[model samples]
Target: MNAPAIDARKWMPYPSAGGAPTTLYCLPHAGAGASTYLPWRKELQPDVDVVPLQPPGREMRMRDEPFENLTPLLNDLLAAMDGVWQEPFALFGHSLGALVAFELARRLSAGEGPRPAHLIVSGRRAPQHPSRLPWIRMADDPMLLEIVRRLGGTPDEILDDEQMRQTVLTLMRADLGVDQTYRYRPDPPLDVPITVLSGSTDSHVTMAELEPWAECGSAGVDIRLVPGGHFFVVTQRETVLRRVRHCLVGSP
Candidate 1:
């Protein structure tokens, strides 16, 4: 199959130092830019390409209106990937991005696009589980910030700036809306394997919440619990990346 061309400006592809045979698409959490995963470029082995999805209203597409409705936004993402997916690849998503990856995987499995070799879903609960958190994204800035502070992800300095805070808040709200408004449409279990990871202490998703992810695929689901809270991927990055590398390469 011919490789689909990916527009460089739309999606950030961190090529391995050497020509890698596989690609790992990294989806960022709500309100984040592609650059959030830029550091992973240096963290992983050169043989694994890391591509971060960049939605509109941030980074290179700053002027473009952000996606409020998840359907069209997800379809657009599937289109972009279909255009450039010619090699073996896997997907890793955190928080809201986890849902995006799940939905995208569903789309790919339904269409001509390629299904991921392995799926790594971190932080977010399984799709079958209903979210219990209030609509914090719609809350006032002070209240929203309070919720975000507890969950952890955005930096303290960025939260301190009024201008940046509002800008980021808008993006975050839209991103969260994607999660809040989502209604799961059940599909058959995917043939691809899945590796589920979560923080041992994360209040956002309990072990029960994470279990449904296993039902999403036919392959045996391997679950890994790391130390820390929701954003443990930051405090425990090397550990996270090591697992990601394992999923991508099928070896530790």
Candidate 2:
């Protein structure tokens, strides 16, 4: 018999509030999971419902294998998030998530799905720029741990346990692999507005690297420099949410 089909609904475990005017689909950074955006619900609710996309191999989907390439992951997400395209929605992603959001927006613009109202990307260089970080799978375990340490959003429990540490490293390798191997294909400019959020002190992504987002969006790109390093999506949460709210709901 054929194996049971994977239920994509599990990718969006959080139920919508029903009162929101629009939905914001948030994707997480490397080594992180959907739960990273869970707190955003309280702040964006009643106007913008926050939907966190949980990729395989982390949190609730821990037993499933993560994608080691961007193509397959994007293909899976396009299929998994089919319902989201039918509504008024926007996309937000940080670091590895940024590439995912950008590609998804591109696919939607190509008529694979309905276009998102806006695309907000954080903590990553524009796709045309070469990645600054080395491929994690090629690095030794200690080096991988050091790289994760410098990025700084990982929880201590996973880092402390030997087995858990190895598991997380595998996940991170798969996540970074998606980033390190991505190739940007030139496409017609997207009609959607793009918002690029950069950390002022983020060594990983320079302002120069963030500026090219303007070329991708025909509607225009808004670049905001927030205070923090790499993980500003977490370090400066309120500021990011305020801007996101302003974009989607006309709120402060």
Candidate 3:
């Protein structure tokens, strides 16, 4: 059977000059749409095209139910990105999106498509590292609320509203399931270079967890600490953009 179709019309593009040799595909964190990267697109050099992936369950596709697992979601995303691989491309993803970017790189390497020239992961630990917290699959309402409270991304309005809270909480639970249930199988390091970014104050991920990214690729690994907490991308936009531009266009 064929995989389900993803609605690509939801994706928004921040196009660049025609002569650029590379495209940077940015993926959003869980519950986030492509709008997250719309601001960064302008900050990048004119030669770098920024394409943000808009997954189901958000924005224009808010009516569609979110995916309960990563496998199906990734399949849909790869399909949505099908014909847009016109140039040497790189990927930048934050938090949950970082995991998606990593997995997508693995898939592209195994598939017939052009492999990404670089992978930029932000606000997430390496896949090989074990999570420190207990799996949240069995959490009750109070427990889930505590987790969400500590995580600090969900807005207060959503937390207070019954309808919005249910919608977001359901999506969060499924996304956390995908993250917790995942097990990294040993594979040879990727040929493409990897650059990992994390916030200095992110309580969830330790330095040890971030270091293991070096093991994922054979070419080279660069890890940097930025300001702010898990949502540092929002707080440190210019610095993040500078580092990303340097990685993609600068030395190997």
Candidate 3, overall lDDT?
Answer: 0.80
Model 3 agreement with the true structure over 4-69: per-residue lDDT tens digits: 664455554443345665789888887677888888766775757788877767766677667766
lDDT tens per residue, model 1, 188-215: 8878788888999998989999988888
Residue-wise lDDT of candidate 2 within 1-252, one digit each (tens)? 975554667678775666688989889998888989899998887788898888999998899899999889888878776655437889999999999999988988888888799999999898999777777768999998888877788887879899988998899888988888888988988899899999999988887888888888889888899999988888899999999999887877
Candidate 2 stretches greater than 4 Å from native: 1-6, 84-86
Query: What Cα-based lDDT does every candidate model obtain?
Result: 0.79, 0.86, 0.80
The CA lDDT at 174 in model 3 is 69
Question: TM-scores for all candidates?
Answer: 0.90, 0.94, 0.90
Q: Pick the candidate with the highest TM-score.
A: 2
Which lDDT value does model 3 have at 64? 66
lDDT of 2: 0.86
* Top of the candidates by lDDT: 2
Model 2 clash pairs are none
Colliding pairs, model 3: none
**What is residue 116's positional error in candidate 1, in angstroms?**
1.5
| True-structure lDDT of candidate 1 | 0.79
